[model samples]
Target: MRNTLNQRRSTRQHFRLLEQLLVATILLQLLNKPAVPVLSTLLQILLLAWL
Candidate 1:
């Protein structure tokens, strides 16, 4: 039925969004790792971007 198909489409969209969030979180953690002292770097980048 149309309802079932719509449900499947919504589920798929949720799954994809979750996957993207997970990947982005992992990437952000990697950037913020202590070895990099990345908070300062990030702040500098943000300042430059804001300007």
Candidate 2:
């Protein structure tokens, strides 16, 4: 039981980090090219799928 709990915690942390990275990437892309709506929409879709 304890091992399972630890594994779950680790997985949660990994997903949290991934979420932050994705958000940062989205922000950077938007900042670098505000005119690229297609890429932005794709990233938003990817983020939504993850959630």
Candidate 3:
């Protein structure tokens, strides 16, 4: 039981890390482009839904 709990915790940590990386990459890519308020807002909404 303890081992299973540890495995689950580790899995969650991995997922959290991946989520952070994905968000960071998206933000970085968007930052490279000229600012578009509407597009950024839509992207944020989509990203939130994905998470």
> What lDDT tens digits, residue by residue, belong to model 2 across residues 1-51?
999999899779868866776676678776886655775676677567756
Of the two candidates 1 and 3, the one with more favorable TM-score, higher being better, is: 1
Order the candidates by lDDT, highest first.
Answer: 2, 3, 1
lDDT of 1 by residue, 1-51 (tens): 999999889778766765665566567777776634454465456446544
The per-prediction tally of clashing pairs is: 0, 0, 0
Of the candidates shown, which would achieve the greatest lDDT relative to the real structure? 2
* Cα lDDT tens digits for candidate 3, 1-51: 999999889778867866776676578667775545555576567557656
Where does candidate 2 stray beyond 4 Å?
33-51
- lDDT of every model, 2 decimals: 0.63, 0.73, 0.69
How far off is residue 9 in model 3, in Å?
0.2
Q: Clashing residue pairs, candidate 1?
A: none
Residue 32's lDDT in candidate 3 = 74
Give me the overall lDDT of model 2: 0.73
Of the pair 2 and 3, which is ahead by TM-score?
A: 2
